[model samples]
Each structure stands twice: as C-alpha cells, then as structure tokens.
Target chain A: MQQTKQRLLTGNKALAEAIRLEMERDPNVFVMGEDVGVYGGIFGATEGLFQKFGPERVIDTPISETAFIGAAIGAAAEGMRPIVELMFVDFFGVCMDQIYNHMAKIPYMSGGRVKLPMVLMTAVGGGYSDAAQHSQTLYATFAHLPGMKVVAPSTPYDLKGMMISAIRDDNPVVFMFHKTLQGLGWMDQLDASIGHVPEEAYTVPLGKANIVREGTDITIVGIQMTVHQALEAAKRLEQQGIQAEVIDLRSLVPLDKETIIQSVKKTHRLLVVDEDYLSYGMTAEIAAIAAEHCLYDLEAPVKRIAVPDVPIPYSRPLEQFVLPNADKIFREAIQLVNE
Target chain B: MAISKDHLLWMYETMYKIRCYEDKMAEAYAEGKSPVFNIGAGPVPGEMHLATGQEPAAAGMCVHLKKEDTVTAPHRPHHHAIAKGVDLNRMTAEIFGKATGLGKGKGGHMHLFDPDVKFSCGGIVGAGIPHALGAALAAKKRGTDWVAVAFIGEGAANQGAFHESLNMAALWKLPLIVVIENNQYGISVPKTASTAVPSNDVRAAAYGIKGYYVKDNDPIDMYNVSKEAVERARTGQGPSIIEIETYRYLGHFQGDPEVYRDKNEVTLLRQKDPIIRLRNYLLNECGVTEETIAQLENKATFEVDQAYAFARESDYPKPEEALEDVFV
Candidate 1:
C-alpha cells in the first residue's frame, strides 16, 4: 500500500515554505519588497524567510514600487529569479508601467531573445473592512494583459505548488493571494483556509483548474477565496437537492476554459462567483467564454455572483454586503439550477 | 586634459557613423513618405524618434563601457544601440522590420535587445531607469564589477520611476550611472517649462548621490564625466547622475511639424556640433591628422551604406511570427 504524508498549513505558510525551498535550491532566487524582510510582509506571507535566507537573499526595499518592481524585471532579464511583493494589488497604479510595460512586455518585445523568470506576488481580497484602496482583487486586470501568467491559488496545497511552478517557469507570473485565505493569526479565517500541504517541493501546473467537488446539476467556477465560498455553497446546495460542481481556477491568464466548458456540458448550468468587480472582470470573461464556446451547454443564461461595481466600503456590513460569499453563491447556484 | 589619439579617433568614428546612419534613415523615410502618409506602407514603418544631435552622449559613455556592462536606452535609442556595440546590420534590419532584425521585427526601433552585449531599449519614458538599476543590482549581488547605465532624457527625470530608482540605487549602493541627455525638449514641451529645477543633475542632491553637469556638447567632456561616474559605480561608490545639456537637430518624431522651437535654434546648435568640435580638438590638440579623419569619415559612410543595403535586402517577417515571441 502507498503512504501519503501531508502537513496542515495556512495559505501564507505554504507560500513561504515554497519560497524557502526555491531559495535553498537556487541561489539566483531572492525576495524584495516593502516590509518583506524584518517586518515579515504586511500580511505575514514572508514571515521567517528573512531569518532563514538572511538579509542578502531576503531584502527589504523602500516603498518605491516602480524601482523595486522594475529592478525585478531587470534582474530576471539577467537570469535571477526574483520574487517581488507588491504590498497590495490596489497599489498597481504606482508601478503598472513596470508590471505591464516592462515585466509583461519584455519577452515579447525582445522577440524571444530574453526570458523573464520573475514572480510578482501581491495580497488581494477584502473581508476585514480595509477601505477601497487597500482591499481589491485585480487579477482580472493583470490577466487581461498579454505576456503575463496570472495565478490565484485557493488552498495551501495549491498555493505551495503553484508558487513553485511560478518560480520555475520562464514567463513572468503574477501570484495573487487573498488576505482572508492566508489564515494569519490576527486575521479571521475559515477552517477551509487550512489544508493538507506536502513537505516535499512539488508543482501544480498553471492553467489547469482543480475540480474540488464533483457534482452533476450545475457548474460553479470560482478563484482564490471564492473557490472556498463555492465549496461551501456546494455543500449547502447538496442539502437543497441541487448538485453543484465546484472548480478552483488556479490560474487566470491561461484560464482553464476546457474544464469549465466540460463541466458546463455535463451540468447544463453555470454560475461564476468572484470577489472582483462585476463588470469587465473574471466573472464576465467566464460568462462570455461559456456563451461563446458552450452556449448550448448552458441550460439557462449564465449567472454571475461578484462584488458589485463599487469600491469596497470601510463599514463591516457594507464590506460584507459588497463581497461575494457562500450565501450569494448558494443563492445564485440555486437560481441557475432552477432556471 | 590630454586624451589618446586613438580614443579620440574612435569617438569621432562612432559619432560620424551615427550621423551617417540617421541621415540615410531620414532620406529613406522622406522617399517612402506616402502622399497620404501611410505609416505601414513606408520602408521604415511606424514612428521614428531619431537621435540626430544626441550622438555624443551615447558614443562618449558607451566608449568607456565593456560588452558586460549593461545599458538601458530610452525612445530615441539608435545612437546608444550603435554605440553599445549592437550589430549594425541587425539594428538596421530591425528598423526596416526584417525577419533577421534584433527583435525579429517584433520590437521596432525603440524596443531593441542585444543580450550578448547586455543592451536593451524601450519606447516608454523613464521606464529604463529602474531596469538599469536592477541590472546593476544583479551585478552587485553576483559580486561582479560590471556597471549598468541608464540613458534617459531630461523629460524622463520628472517621472516617478526616476526619483524612485535614484533613491534605491543610492540606498543599496548599486553600480548604476544615470546619464540624462538633456536635449532641451520632451517631444514639444521644453525642459524649462516642465521641470521645476534648473538642471536635471541638481535632482541628484535629493537622492544624496553625486551629480555631474556638462554644459557643452563635447564628447570628450562627456567621456571624462562618464568615466568618473562609471568608475565610482564599479568601485562600489554607489550611483551618480550626469546631465549633459544638448540639442536635437530633428523633430521628436518623423514628420513632427516642430512648431515648438525657434526656427534658428537647430541651425545655431548645429554650428556647435560635438562631432565637428571633436574633429577640431583631435586635429589641433590630439595631433590627429586630417588624412586619418577623412579615412574614418569614409569608413563610417561605407559602413552606414552597407547597413542600409543589408536592411533593404532583408525580408519582412512571416505573418505567423507575431505569435512566436509573446512567451519564452
């Protein structure tokens, strides 16, 4: 009989462990960002890395996103695989040039002569009432741009694996982790946030979706924290006699449209749950994909449960109201199944 | 300051080569200009930001650099690309949108990358500054003495990336030299109108790094200043800013009507051309013979002609090539 060994870990811990493994394996790998060294990252995603890697490998940079991020691009061009952290995805405004113009466009611009093996990691999602600027999941924005592979891993197992894959990949990868799903000590997290992560270094290939729960009646596609919400909704829908298949879209750019279309073909119903804004987002793109390729497979008009087109509010009630949750996913799934 | 005769000749040859290549490009561009001005139909399609007058800075600074030293050039980058030892045949082919171009015809003129010489350029203003810093940081981390230079315009000095890069380079003590080719204009907007400070070099004080200013267009002076900055960076003295006040003889881009500057400004600036000044200095001070100068000029013209011929003979990339370089 084969033996399976796994350790329970939070999303943040798993990410750090994966980075530590890569640093140990490759001397070219280094970490640089605001509060990444001594402060252990604003959300503890980089905790214990500085002590283990030392200040040389685990560098603390000034709050200059453009400089540090662009530096990561240059370093990547010169064969160093740098994991740069943008404290928040919302702060892309200050350094979008480095991200889109250089990091994303260099390989294309260089005509395959250069490869950018860099990871731009940032914190996403907003359940803790961190206002408009602090709380946003803008994976769609990065995914929309060409030359960047955007990944949002939901579980500890997937996060660790995807991170290793991102580091090993030659293309520039944008790794976005939801704040609530990180399972930090201070932040309130769901039991689903902790998962069985293997100690060994492994990779979950990008652009592949994981079918978390298999069902028949409906297909629900979600990413990052929404995947957990969809799972919870799937359990609730099971109680209501509506079987919902949940898909965790691990990577956004190389979107797993095959799995989504296949699931929709089987279930005949589709509901996309996302924490990003409603319009021009991942939800809309998924809906469009279903309409474009698998229109007949969709039994009813594809339903989307996403944050309304509004900035995340500061108030707890308003924040919760705007964010997509299990109740929202469950309701949407039911309506899709019934219709 | 006494300069070697061979070094002066080399600088002059490089500058002359740039002038000849740009002159031919302008002529070719004019001949290819459609009555309706179709950018794609021309021999050299798309916007061309020619470095007509800023050749000295690139030649001077690049002369002091090795193949291992990296250079990140801005939009008007042909001069720097040539000076940094980019293959002239491929560069011209790239400008002509040929399959054998530096970027396989994908990166037009502005986005050239020659990894062999660690040279790259882009169209975005101030974007290359931080990239050069990153290159410098890589060299520093690897314990190499190779330095990285960022060739930016005075207009780019106002960009947030510039300040941020300068500060970071100083803090980390990375081997970086930021050379600002203050050519008096950013497209149509003059430097005096856009910048609050009198000179771009003065901004170096804000970052707590050394700054050097060259008021004239002499390539020797540029070489001297850049040598100091490059040596400082290679010796672990951190980053420094060197601002060279110069002028562009041509409009920002091809067919720019150039309604911004005084009509006589370019004419007057051409009289003080660095290439001419260097020829005179080499002849009088460095004892470089007129015959040697003539030979060098002829050689540059022949090389430029050869590059043009090579580009003209090259074939455009296949339509399917557009999808090739988007990833590794």
Candidate 2:
C-alpha cells in the first residue's frame, strides 16, 4: 500500500489542491471565472492557483456567464479540460440558455462526434441568510436536467477526491460546494467541513454514496450541508435507543440507489433530509427510490424534511422556519423509528 | 437641438424623486440589520440593488417615452421604474413583500413587474435585453409607435444575450433602444479590465445601427444623446445603442462587503453627484429659482415617505401564498 500524508484541510483548500494537481498533470486543464484568478475565488475554491499558474492558465473573466461558460464549452469541444466557476449557482439565470440548451445538449446533438470535457463548479446552500438571490441550493434543478453529471460532496476528503475525478472526466460535470462548508473565515462552518485530506492526488469515483455512520433502526440520506445535519440527527437519535444510519449522497445524477436500498433493507426505515425546495426535489427523488424498490422492506412510510417550496425568505425567523435543521431531522427520525 | 424648459424641469424633478426614493430605501433596508449585519434580518430583505447615482440615465432617456412604450430594466431598477412612472406605494409594498405589492409580494425588488406602466425588471444581468427585443418586435408587427427600452449595466454588454439581442434588433429594424449604463464596475471588476473596447457605443457600428455616447453621467448629455436615438426608433429606423458613462454610489447589493474597490472612490464620485450637477445647470444656465427646486424636493420626499408608510402598514402575504404565483 502506498503511504499518503494526511493533514486537516477545509473543503475549499482540498478542491484547490485537486485542481492544482490536475492542471500540473494535464496541459489542457485551465481555470476561468469572475474572481477565480486574482481574487482566488470568492469562496476560495480556486485559492492560491493564480499565484502558481499565472494569468495564462488561471483567467479572470468579465461578469458574462454566457460568454465565458459557452467559451469554456467551445474550448472543451476542441480538446481542453476547462474548469469554469459560475461564482454562485443562483447566478445561472442569465446564462441558462448556454447551460441548458448548448452545454447540456451539445453532446447528444452532435451524435457522439464531439466530446465536451468540462467542469462547471459553483457555490451553493444557505445558512448565513444571504437572502433569496444569493442563497439557494438548486441541486435538483441541475440534477433534473440530462447530460450533466452533478456532485455535491459534504467532506474535505470527498471534495478533493471527487474534484480530481471531475477534472479528468470526459463528460460534463457540475460540482457544487456549499459556501458554509468551505471553511471560509467570513462564514460559519460546521466541524464536518474540515477533515483529514490526503496530500496525493486520488479520485473518489462519481455515482457513489458514502455511509458516514452505520446504524440498524433507520437510514437517513442527505447531501452537502444536509449530510452533516443528518449526522448530527443520527448522533442525537442514538441516545434514544435508536440506531440511525447516515448516508451521504455525494452524487445526484448517478444516484447510489443500491447503497440506500441496502441500508433501508437493514434499518427498515428511511428519512430524506434536503436543503433544496421540497416539491419535486431531492427528497422526492430519494423517497421515490425507496418506494420503487424497498417499499416492502420499509417498516413505516418514508419521511422527508426540507425547505418548503418558498423562495428562501429574507427574514431570519422565516428562513429558519422553512429550512430543514438538525432538530427537524431528529424529530422526523424519532417519529419514523417509533412507527 | 435645444431641450425645452418644461422637459428640463421634468428631468430634474424625476432625478430628485429617484434620489429621495433611494435614500428612503437605504434607511428602511438597514432596520433590524445592524451590528452583525445579517442580510435576511432586515424589513426590506433579499438583495437590494439601489440606483443611487444612476438617476440621470433613467430620467434623461425615460423623459421622452410615452405611456404605451415598454421599459425593461436590470437588477438596479428603481430609478428606471420611477422614471417610467410606476406606482411608488405599490413598488415599495412589493419590495417589503406585502400582499398589496405589484406582484402581491411574489416578485421582490429585483423581480418587479409593473405592467401598468409598461415596466419590468429582473435580477439577471442581461436577461431583460431579449425581452425588450420581443416587445419591440411586437410593436413593429402591430404597426405601432411603441418602442421598447432595455436598460442594462456595462457588465451586461459583455453577455451573449445582449449581443444577440442587438443583432436581432438591428437585422429586423425593430423599434428598440438599448442603453448601456457604464457604471465603471460589475460588482468589483472595473470596465477597463472587463471591456475590450474603450467605448461601448462603437459596437453599434458592427450592427449597422446609430450609436450615441454620453460622458460624465450628465443628465442633459444623456437626454441630448437619446433624443435622436428615440426619434430614429419611433420612425422605424431600427434600433440605437446609447452607452452612458456612470458610477455606482452604493455596493452591488445591500450588505456587500466591497473589499475589491477603493473605499475613497465613492466619495470622489459623490463630489460630482448627477442631481447636484443638474440642479446647478438649471439654476445657472436655465435661470430656475431656488423655491421651485425646494418645492420639487419637498414633493419627492413627501411622496417617498407616504409610500414607505404604506409599505410598513401593509400586511405580508400568507406563508402558503408562495405556491400561488409559481404557476401563474
């Protein structure tokens, strides 16, 4: 076995390391976004890259998402692995035509002739009350669209590994990182945000779910920030004589149904926790998976805790009330385990 | 061509109204958001993009528009909306997320849609340009003099939608006017670093359309420039591009920690506030009295105050009401 050095690192640092490693290995790999160069990314995803690679490889672009994102697509088509940042996932509205119509559909439209290898990374999630415009985890929105491989890792290890895998992947990938979990000084971070990340470049393959905690009573599934919330809920549930298994669904498109189904088979219950809008969201997707395959295995009906379909209100109290929290997940888990 | 005295006074009053309204909004937006500055804690929550120093761009161009014309604005839309004659109380109520709002609290400040005044705006940078194109296309098809105006920032000019819309507008000869408000910055990146061209008006030549460039964020300059463009569009002479050099007095949004820009930049820009410049021009060049200016100022302040009071008194929509407007 190869020895790997481990050190505590935030999700942002881990991501930056992965990109730096990949760019060094591959000549085609480059980074571009609004502040990704000199600013090192507002969320620190591309931190320290500009200093190392210079402006040629790490480019700072204008606030034109359509132009640069579309340009990235063009560059990718012509044999370049471009990792473009959308700044914030909420800012996709202006350039959605290029995203949904062109970038997402080009491969299929070209009928296997053109290979568009690119990674579109963006910051998502909201706990800091960034209001409606800046604060949103539109995971389901991207996952719903075909031709895009969507991934949102909850840990630094997963972030670094998955980012490496994404940079090398030939297909288009949408990598989303929760701003709060990036371990930035300005934002509040959970203990789970930082973890022992390996120094060597290793890839955590896409379309796999990580069982963060093992339990027997019920299975709790979550992604990004909600994964930590689920873990917290599981810990609290353990004191009540309930064993709650926590599954981190790092990939959204190639959803790891087998792991979730197996967990439900052992636990006999399922609860989906999400930060995205409730209706037609990840919760519904996970719940549907259980209903489809493990319906008979589940002891009780599946439960879901998520932000109600409101466009995240600006008032703190209202936003808190709508958003899914550890307490909400715990309450739902307790009731599900009881039943 | 000389601007009429009545038109000059109208522009001044409108500029003053926009300034007063923005001042009131800034004050109200700070309530419950202090010490720590939690963005969602305030009364007028969400992203607030105040057009504090952009009154000249709005008032100058909008002074020529009639009731039938459509005006599409970018995220920082209050100045354009006010200039286009949107109801102040309803607009305020909308920003406050009250049931009596423009969209019954469904659309916030950035997503304001006041069809009564043929005005609408969205949070997206260059998203409104195509909408203005469609409106202008409709006017041309209907054989009407109703031109559509799309007010976008300097940053938005770099968007693919802006370029596409310009090409389509020129090719079809639609009665459209695209105003590029060169606010020197897109959040933090300056125009010099972002834009490839020294002047955006030069881009109009590529589309074979008339181009007008306004300097120093001057209201009268903007008015003089837009006058010929407006007449050209109204007479079915296709579209025109008007690029005005302007400055943003506030941050991109409320609560934005603007570390990217020099702190002293705003103070230097404020030294040449467009409203004050227009007021001085009226006083010195046009022989306008101080009492008249004071009356307009008082009127604008009173109207803005009444709107704020109305917004404060209005009730918020029911929590379940969020589901109502998604489909409609």
Q: Pick the candidate with the highest lDDT.
A: 1
lDDT score of model 1? Answer: 0.91
**List of chain B TM-scores, one per candidate:** 0.98, 0.98
RMSD of each: 1.4, 17.9
Q: Pick the candidate with the highest DockQ.
A: 1
- Report the lDDT tens digits of candidate 2 across residue range B1-328: 8888788899989999998899889989999988878788888888899999988999999999998888888889999999999999989998998988887776678866666677777666886776677567557655788888999999999888878778777877888899999988899898999999998999999899998999999999999988888999999999999999998889998877899898999999999999999899989999999998998888988888899999999999898866452111
TM for every model, in the order presented, reads 0.98, 0.54
Regions of model 1 farther than 4 Å from truth:
A1-5, B34-40
Could you tell me which residue pairs clash in candidate 1? none
> What is the C-alpha DockQ of each candidate?
0.88, 0.02
Give the residue spans of candidate 2 off by over 4 A. Answer: A1-5, B1-159, B162-328
* Cα error, candidate 2, residue A21 (Å): 0.4
